[model samples]
Target: MNHAIFEKNSLILLIGTLIVVSIGGIVEIAPLFMIQSTIEKVEGMRPYSPLELAGRDIYVREGCYNCHSQMIRSLRDEIERYGHYSLAAESMYDHPFQWGSKRTGPDLARVGGKYSNDWHVEHMRSPRAVVSASIMPGYPFLAQTPLKAEHIEEQMRTLRIVGVPYTDEQIENAQADLLAQVSPEAPGGAEMQKRYPNAVFADSPSKAGVTEEDALVAYLQHLGVSVDFKLYDDKANIR
Candidate 1:
């Protein structure tokens, strides 16, 4: 039988399996090589600020992706509920994009600017405090724990090596920016603001030092805000 050939000849089976897998991989990956030039970009899209990047790391570390998805599907219902559908250009800088397929909580594609920082803080401390039916757990400790940002520059440097386009100045000032983002009147914040116009500078009432809460809120407030969907031309992406 055909099965007997593979079962008896281990070397032949190994070679045959590798050949099949290679062919399958080639079929899946070759199209991307051919289509790389066809990629389109929208305006106002920029790399995440240092604070937001740190928050994104915390988001991943806390397994927030388990409950929430960042991707909004093209379906009409999804678009209506979560603003415009997600754009490839929006996720271009993501080392591993967060376009997850789970929906234990709502999609977060357009959650930016939807609620105030205070509301987010309250929600984070206890979701049910604001949303009575919420099943999400509280992260009260986030506000108490100071953000560990001394190595932010090194993180930015590593991201640059992976094609994030972080400039030398950005990497050099990463730690400053992280601290500046949580203080509206911080002297160093002026440069950070200039570098990131969309970045929100909030004053944390409870803590003098920036905390994990501040970083995560910054990241949440930065999502789905890079580009103006009204100005976007959907046809340009079709190839």
Candidate 2:
């Protein structure tokens, strides 16, 4: 019953600790299975297209997550500042998830469609040029660096293995989609649309071919624009 008794008998202490820990873990984890079903279903929540996924990789590679957070807390200020509060379904397909902890810059959860592609290109090239008071470093190299997407198919296959929902057709056309997103006039526009119905195809003037800037911009433009919150009751989905 006392600490001395448990310490005196190692076997008994081990057994008793395991029993206590198991009970505590079950108490915490058992309800998750049931509660998962009760999560509110929202419309327009779709997985990131191959192009967006590639851009996401570039985002992570550049340590953008170090300054920005993708998750917006369910708070009054956050909702007012960054549209509706973040939803679980918004990041359902994110492998490691980019719900960062720091806020050196503003939250980028709802940054998609918040600015034009040209504006983003300018900002990335020279953050101070766009925002005089900005402290973020410029990424001019992204525009100059050509995007390498030869392994895009393999990347999609790997993501699919990890629950990203990439289909065979999507994997097959990953390179084409990546090119088409940044080059709207490209020949694969039709194929890209067929594979990713919700994708945005636009011309990026930063590069003749696909550039790192194009990929990063594509990923940034997709931050929190997936779900259409207009149809949902904002008051009801605050949590």
Candidate 3:
């Protein structure tokens, strides 16, 4: 009865297609240009450290993104469950941005600091130990294998090329940030402070080399921190 409908290329279809495409493209890109203002407030958020940077390289090499995503969406269930909605600035440092397309497991953007180093080590060793039903493969090597610190500088350089900000001052003061994160009250506390007035220190350097566990921990800890269970308002600042 309506054979012509199958053959017809209606003008409405073209207009609708263009409208949908335009809206999607705008929604995808417009926020990028306007987000630096909000990102400025994430003072605690910083570039990954040398060893932790190396760990990140390992994370990428392992294709952790295959199962996990780093970006949390701006939805109610996501916010209520994961924490604050994912912010544009939180991910400004990610070169390609790991806001993965699917949630095979869960969003890792805020998985930083969700567990302890020992826990992460165990989870890497055996995901089932932590999550009874996790289909994740075990990374037991992360524990048995000591991380190589040799290429840390090269890694840092590579990140710099890719837009992760690491200042000469930060590099020089890296140890200070490392110390600050380790034991802020250690005997060398005064000395570290005196030396690195502007340096941000991390805690321990796991067997995974000199990667500051603290900085990595900081990055992890910051995930989902923006989640304030309270009602939302424009004035809300990320803690």
lDDT values, one for every candidate: 0.85, 0.81, 0.59
Q: Write the per-residue lDDT of candidate 2 for residues 108-216, one digit (tens) a residue.
A: 9999889988889999999999999999999999888888878878877887787677777777777767777877788888888777665775468854678888888
TM-score of 3: 0.63
Local error of candidate 1 at residue 198 (angstroms): 0.5
Best by lDDT: 1
* lDDT measured at residue 9 in model 2 versus the true structure, 0 to 100: 95
lDDT, candidate 3, 1-239, per-residue tens: 65455347677667767999999999998988976554544544567654345455566667877888887677667766766667676677776676777888888876755676566655666889999999998865554454455555555677788777877765665544444444445445555445333223334435343332333344444444443434443324423
Off by over 4 Å in 3: 1-41, 173-239
Give the alpha carbon lDDT tens digit for every residue of 1-239 in model 1.
56998999999999999999999999988898877544476788888999999899999999998889999877777776787878888888887788777998999878888898999999999999999999999999999998887888888888889878889988888888888888788779889988887898756767658899999999999999888888863534534
- After superposing candidate 2 on the true structure, give the runs of residues whose Cα lies further than 4 Å from its correct spot: 1-27, 33-41, 236-239
Candidate 1's C-alpha runs over 4 A off are: 1-38, 233-239
Against the hidden reference, what TM-scores do the models get?
Answer: 0.83, 0.83, 0.63
